[model samples]
Target: QQQVKQSPQSLIVQKGGISIINCAYENTAFDYFPWYQQFPGKGPALLIAIRPDVSEKKEGRFTISFNKSAKQFSLHIMDSQPGDSATYFCAATKGYSGAGSYQLTFGKGTKLSVIP
Candidate 1:
């Protein structure tokens, strides 16, 4: 069974609209959750992250709502802009691991487009 599941595979939002995506995880050991955003011909980079200990986290135009009890999390894009168009990925892993030894497990990815 897949450890993580994300849906809608793709999304479209007009500039200034809100964009949302969701995910679920089966591993309770995964205490760290992160969302990555990627543009075409580029690598995915960290956008926002939350820990099981926290219920929510926000950074600029991105927000992450985490439901620890349900083992789920979701991302919300506020004040969406055309530049926000990219692929988004939800990932989870242990919060603390040895240096240079941490790795992330990612969802297939959701492609988001913000029309200008």
Candidate 2:
């Protein structure tokens, strides 16, 4: 299990703009970082992720930036759209399968609103 810290209780972005979310973890044991997007009445779905060794990772319009020394990471959503509006959560885990505990601790989500 890993503890996570996230910010921006909420956000509002214009259509075609960029959406940003940030998270941090103090536990060096955490090796995997992932962001999840959730819609109303639906389970959170994996959006993007990055490893501590990777400085940055991008997929489509989503990007993840990781800073190992600072134990911090952030998510950037480019070309924001109305469909992209949702609650975003940042999570961290140790990626241990042979352990007694395997869980992902998430932070208070950032509610992003993209204006049309």
| lDDT (10s digit) by residue, model 2, range 43-102 | 999998887888999999999999999999999999999999999999888874445365
Query: On residues 60-98, what C-alpha lDDT tens digit does candidate 1 reach at each position?
Result: 889999998899999999999999999999998874554
Which residue pairs clash within candidate 1? none
Error of 1 at 41 (Å): 0.6
TM-score of each: 0.92, 0.92
